[model samples]
Target: MKNTIILSILLLIFIFNTEAQKSAEVISIGEKVTFFSKTLNEERRIWIYVPDQTSFQKKIEKRYPVLYLLDGESQFYSTVGLVQQLSQANLNSILPEMIIVGIENTNRYRDLTPKVNSTPFITFLEKELFQYVDEKYRTAPYKLLVGHSLGGLLTIDILTNKPEMFNAYIAIDPSMWYADEQFLNQTISQLPKQKLTDRKLFVGIANSLPPNVTLKNVSKDKSSETRHIRSILKLGDFFSKQPNKGIQYKQNFYENENHNSAPLLTQYDGLRFVFDFYQSDLSEKDFQDSTSLIVTKLRNHYQKVSKGLGYSVAPEEEFINYIAYDALGKKHFSKAKSLFILNLENFPQSNKTHAAYADYLAATGDIANATEFYEKSLQIKDDKAVQQRLLTLTSKGMTLTESDLIQYVGQYVLDDYKITIVLELKDGKLISKVPGQADSEFVPVSKDVFTVKDKQGYNITFHKTNDTITGFTSVQPNGIFKATKKS
Candidate 1:
């Protein structure tokens, strides 16, 4: 048994490596775009990352919020990856997927710093970049701006002077000591008067203090070495004391992180703070209880989130579908029905939404409505599994009894490949297991046909002769292969 387990582990590793090798291709995160800036009167190169629309099941074109980043060449990749991870991976849904537009600097001082109350950079962004991005991409009204060091100074300047430009701002260790702390003083005075309602600002202060200095004594030192941190601390303290209109604000001090290493962590924290209402945490009890009022709760949550984001936000179709299915599985039919209907109403064009509703209907024994919904789903996309399901529902001699399914359960072998498959009945579901592979659950489409769950375009068809089980054939996209019954 020990030897067998070791060999099985090695075989699994070999298969994984082989699959990885097959998928070895150039992985690109974002694209570099160049356009002439009429405001600046020169060409500017920007890096852009837009979420792939094809990966989503919604047939309707999706629009996304945009995040504008300063120092595009350096910050573009990490920001893009962070957004993708937070929004897309493992159903995280912490933040909404956003388009990242990073502006590569031509001259840091000329573009990012204010020259005698004139902001040519702000003018360029407002007149040129905003128009370009909105025209070229499917962008929502929401926008965010992030900057560090001198860029952070420019960000603060924008927030104080032109607060309407971006919905949220992140300033990472800004050089507030510029020009005898003029912008810093201006920001402190102006912010209290400006009614920045629904707007957000996140300030990240890095440890710029000397080895001997601490937060308590740093305010007294006032040396050029501690000037950077002192200015930031002063600004933070003012924010804590003063009532800054209606703008949401947060600040963090990274004791061990310096200017260069602070931006990444700050960006993550800033995004979370800005969009804390994005994900609704639904507990397991909510799924198990039919009277939990999940539908009402979800509606109210999304409404609040929509208000915060300045858009009409709906719960994600996939999220709703998963919850609906969970309710259906737990036999909470009424709860499942309401959630499924809600999903359909929100995502009318989504194929998965229609199919999920169909599944709920089928489970509740509403065959006619289930068939209609499945057909509606197929009208949007040609899904083989749905097609098979429809065929099985309509066809005669396809619906099997428990005893009929039991006859097909046993061991089968492919002599040529030396492969064996064991089919077993577990909780009224057929399960298939092969050596060195994970067990796959089968969804019965017909008495003889079963589709592997989560495995697209793959089916197993059992053959019989003389009222006895003979064998089965594995039908895959590649080809159909036969296996002989061993029991």
Candidate 2:
């Protein structure tokens, strides 16, 4: 009687599920798009992830390299997350930001194996997929391909036969015993013929043998179950002994991990090796030694990276701008000048670069060049901040000479507010400091009038009696206050 009642309940629930499904809500995690491919006479679907518009900076368009992944349905989410975590999190930029394209397979055996003549799939990638993506998104010329298992076999095939398709290739635990070692023998024979300069390949080997079998004696015992591991071992040995074909190749053996649990770690290791030239380090002494030396090292480092990537890669404009402002604040004028000028050369079209250069000039009291770059920046983009700065500079009685600025350097105190402000001249610029607070810079806007740098709507004006400095008035958003000159 209990079983009969349970069956009746289940049958009623199933009958009513169709009606209940009408109100169901859809949960979308990410983007998936489809396009019909003429080469395969079928529709293809792919998952894509690109950096957010604000990932790098505001109003700056940046292009990134593409990483084409196989087995999209299973690998898409983890790969995208890994790329984001490595490139953007915790002040760590171990890898360059990239666009990830995961290709969803329609038929694994038909599309991923050379035995099934996967030429049409390759044709679809080259003729249809590449063109479609290039036309739709901002992509750098450099490309990387990653595959696992049978997909890994396909990856190796592409590296051997179509070396120019991608700049880097990662094969994770490939089934090398496919079709009686035909693919393996073909790869070994064709590898010597291909010129792999400026290319990189990373192969990951997983432990696929029985619990009792080990690397030392597994080779002697040839069983059908052990064929996969032996075949991968042979390919690894070939790579080790072969003459240098200009390809940067590496193979990693994961003894503790099995075939099913290797792709995650393998992908991480593979990317690091392929992009070994990308990350750069600097010592404290390097920054202290010479500013020019820092610039030279950066140039040389990117040059090496550019050669490896087969494209021109400039130092990021934001990095240069940050260090420039840092040097300017530290009174390292020469260092700041070099960094600012480098940005102007590398990113001539960027309004931020021009505006930043204008800020440096304004801080250093070069009114003419500052005015020129500020106008140039406005011409490119109508930024309200830049426009306000230009308006302030062009206003009458706003320009003040260094000699005129030197007169106002003195200690002052606001008795009513119980606040003390100290002013000093360093590198021909006025710096203001309050006890237990960070130092503030004062940029001259007019005779005896100044604006606090980087702080909006804050200004100070000085009063004089018989050409002698007396006191100053502070203007802020909240209210106006007065400070008397103490020294």
Candidate 3:
């Protein structure tokens, strides 16, 4: 009896340890570093986050993609969290796990800009900053450069002159026309008729100037600032008209978000555009039924758009494959696998697609195929999180349990706006549906707090009186709406 009790205690401890190891781990807080600049001859500071590779599986050994961000002090944490959450959600697999470098500014004008006649400091980025980052980090050839305001101007300069430096570029409210109207007009004249190949650029314009402001050259009343804004828009219009061959370009005009509030919206939209293929809206079923036909149709569609717009559409396989993985997360296994195979034909380099397919294989108890694809994904990109998830799925058997139905349905009303949320139980899962939107399965984050993986823009919480739900609050992207359940 004594031996049996001791053995039972040991078994319990082992099980607990195994379970703990299977859970996901949060990314480590990034480090701050300051380096001497050669261009401006001043010190520049930056924030850096390396993915949690320590937890990565031993089978995978590889470097990762790099993202260079401006406004390090203000937006670093938010961008990092967004990348992690988006990747975890697997929404269209639009983003890949990579290192993020946030460049902190010593003097905004000196480092972020390309030229400064009024300011004493020269452009640090042009002189020594870019070389410094390359030397310090284990960066890959595939890199994305992001900036806003003066930084945005620098991004444009790089795109215009040294396009080979980075794979992707994002500029938010760039001061492109700051050098003067003559400089912008000259730049437009010098633009090449041919499209840039194998490159991507995203430009965002905010609601800084009123809509009534006239931009024509013949305008009688013109201020220097107005001319500046006009020049930037003119350049935007130019890019919009250019042919699509080697380059993919997009422009976003934010009427609601001003210059100060534009960064958040721009960052999200810019990333989405650069990774457009990964964030496609196609359903997994679409890919499974006819992968070849879908790819052909998409290619033809892009060819037409490219000819008319002067830029290439995102690769079809990447978009389809990402959609498949997303479907799998919602428990559609066969659909996910079919999409993965289709995507592999187009984007053989995408490791995320393989990893997602591996997950589907594991779910159906196809251990051999699951292991193969898991290793394949790791080979392309060393993703530790995926490896850990695989280990959990394989080792501990998971069982789905149904929960009892509860009454928590009601109409939520706020000032000037109304949102009706219906709470229903389906197969033991609490599902919430909003009018005109798709139903979302909510996972209880807390006793009364529930979250939907499908929607990041809102938070839904319920208030209960005794065993009955009395009221519920619906938090949206812009504002919050509260409603009491009708008695």
lDDT by residue for model 2 (1-487), tens = 9999999999999879977898787743357899999999999999988866216443236778899998988898888878878876664567887888999999888888875345788888888999988887788899999999999998998888889999999999998889999999999998889988888999999988887999888889789989998998888889999878788889898988889899988999999998888887766776665465788888888898788778888888888888888888887878888888889998999888999998888888876567667767877888999988876764522545668677888889986887888898877678999999899878766567766666544557789999998988877656788999886
Model 3, which residues run further than 4 Å from truth? 1-28, 53-62, 90-92, 116-138, 193-195, 211-221, 241-245, 280-487
lDDT: worst 10-residue window of model 2: 51-60
For residue 479, what is the lDDT in candidate 3? 66
lDDT of 1 by residue, 317-384 (tens): 77778888888888888888999999888989888889888888777665545656777788789898
Q: Higher TM-score: candidate 1 or 2? A: 2
Model 3 C-alpha lDDT per residue in residues 322-426, reported as the tens digit of each score: 666666666666566665676676556878777767777877776545655666676688787876765554333223244333654444443345555666678
List TM-score per model, in order.
0.72, 0.75, 0.50
- Which residue pairs in candidate 1 have backbone atoms (N, alpha carbon, C) closer than 3 angstroms, thus clashing? none
Give per-model CA RMSD.
16.0, 13.0, 25.3
Candidate 2 Cα outliers beyond 4 Å, as residue runs: 1-30, 53-60, 116-118, 284-290, 396-487
Evaluate candidate 2 by giving its C-alpha RMSD to the native, one decimal.
13.0
Candidate-wise lDDT, in order: 0.85, 0.83, 0.64
Any idea how many clashes model 3 has?
6
Model 3 residue pairs with clashes:
197-246, 198-246, 242-310, 243-310, 244-310, 244-311
Predicted model with the maximum TM-score: 2
